[model samples]
Target: MIAYDLMKRLKELGYIKEERDPYWWPKSGSFEVVVGAVLTQNTKWENVEKALENLKNELGSIEPQKIVEMDQKRLAALIKPAGFYNTKAFRIQKLVHNMLDEYGSFEAFQKRPSRSWLLAQKGIGFETADSILNYACYKDFLVVDAYTARILNFLGYELQTYQEIQEFLSDSILENLDRIYELYGQEMPLSQIYARFHGKIVEFCKEHCKGRDQAEKIKELLV
Candidate 1:
């Protein structure tokens, strides 16, 4: 099945029903997404949520400047539930410091983000950078992860690289923009499409990509 077909199926299955908080990711354009993107690496979202709650309770908000000003040890302690606390804390602080130095604030960075600049950060890779771009900055960049690779492999695609998988899914949706508009009953922006599409993929895989019948179940549902 193609990416748009999967998107349609997921939508029918009741995913991405609205643009709001309490979804797979935080609300769009929140710095929490940037922090969650980094903390979510090699960890589950539940742990990330716990860590985020700790930060919120301690700092009142997940501000970049507050994070940069806080001691690394304290930061690590608050985010310990997310795993790799010390390392993630260092990476987060460095990223926030650089963001403030370059863009002055998260609002400024949101106004004008640089993918290349994000890639230059200590721990930000393609997936993480794209997560921030798509979810946090509301850019028309699709974020793919291990779930995407697994789902595509089950669907009989030979895409072996991140760029290939991303391009395939993105081009599929772009090619069917008119159909997508028809499906949604309005002209949705490319960034919103990318966000919901990625969210659907992640949520679908989490629900069905488990147990010994994982491949069979996914094929049965989507194919």
Candidate 2:
């Protein structure tokens, strides 16, 4: 199956560093993950991390209520490293307000983060929504970013839409859960598998297949 093959090839190549065990994304189910999901739009993860650290230093917390109560100017200044600071700060405030008004708290929001609800938010797109779902809420939605699309496209999987790629991955995963269990000697939930898959693709792209020459080198390594 494609899932098994992809996972095996990714493992044999060892693209991700050993430090990120189980997965390579940020710490799951935390406010930091949620903020990072939004902050990382159209920017590098390194920039988002700087913004996160800045926010932590400024407010001592990234919680929803704290974000809501903070002055918009201060919030924007703290997250300036993320780029599009004013817009991102406004979006985060709006997200926090929505959480408080609808779900009462981040804890409650994470309990059942509706995909439609997330998509309806001001700054949320498909990839961002799914990142919040999987990483922040620990939900089963798999994120398909540019890296996922590029690698698959390079490998001759030409999908037209995000839904197409998502469904393809879901189908592959459904057909290969048994193989995952067989290899790991334990049952891996759909969410965990999706998280790890997304993380691995991100790490692999970041480290190995960057530009065309880098991609060719990766192809050689794989062979």
Candidate 3:
């Protein structure tokens, strides 16, 4: 029932449609997904795709061991299009090496129970960690990105802190990991839905909501 209503409103506002079902949804337990999450920070996915392609075509694989062992200068050159190449390359290589050193393999890293520890990694942030958790590890956790905050605040939901936003979105919806994961396959859970939802919101805001205060804009236009 709720999904129906949400979909209806989102569609009316041109946020989603049936054709979006097969739009490159991440498969669980892939090393590429985690690396993509990291590289995707503050950059467009197209650039990330290019970087991944370079790593794969020239380096043979996108595995952590391979990435960690690659020359930093060459890796940076390959991922330069993704922006912040120097720093990101170092971070990516270090992260991959750390995963190997600590967990033996990417699969082993995924199987570990130390989510908090993983989150505490050098290049990992809240959104990045949550992305890795949900997409790579297939764990249930709400990913609070800039779009989530903007859309929520525009919708008259005010969160004072980042943690508050996380709690609100995670609590208001899914109660368990299994249920959350289930939403992705069936109709898109708040976790998965929020990413694309937020993506669409950013698109909408850029096209229509510009120059207007978000709160007033959402109320006047979206509602």
lDDT winner among the candidates?
Answer: 1
> Where does model 3 exceed 4 Å of error?
1-8, 11-28, 175-214
Ranking of all candidate structures by their lDDT, best first: 1, 2, 3
**TM-score of every model versus the real structure:** 0.95, 0.93, 0.78
Per-residue accuracy of model 1 over 142-165 as CA lDDT, tens digit each: 998999999888888889899999
Write down the RMSD of candidate 1 (Cα, Å).
1.8
Go through the candidates in order and give each one's C-alpha lDDT: 0.88, 0.82, 0.68
Q: What is the lDDT of residue 93 in candidate 2?
A: 92
Cα RMSD for predicted model 2: 1.7
Tens digits of lDDT, candidate 2, 1-223: 7656776678666745544535357667887777888899989988998999998898887888899999999999999999999999999999889878999988888897899998999989999899888878878888898888877766667888898988888788888888877766789878878888887788888876665745556556543
State which candidate, 1 or 2, has the greater TM-score: 1
Q: Which residues of candidate 1, in runs, are more than 4 Å off?
A: 17-24
Q: Give lDDT for model 1.
A: 0.88
> Candidate 1: worst 10 consecutive residues by lDDT?
16-25
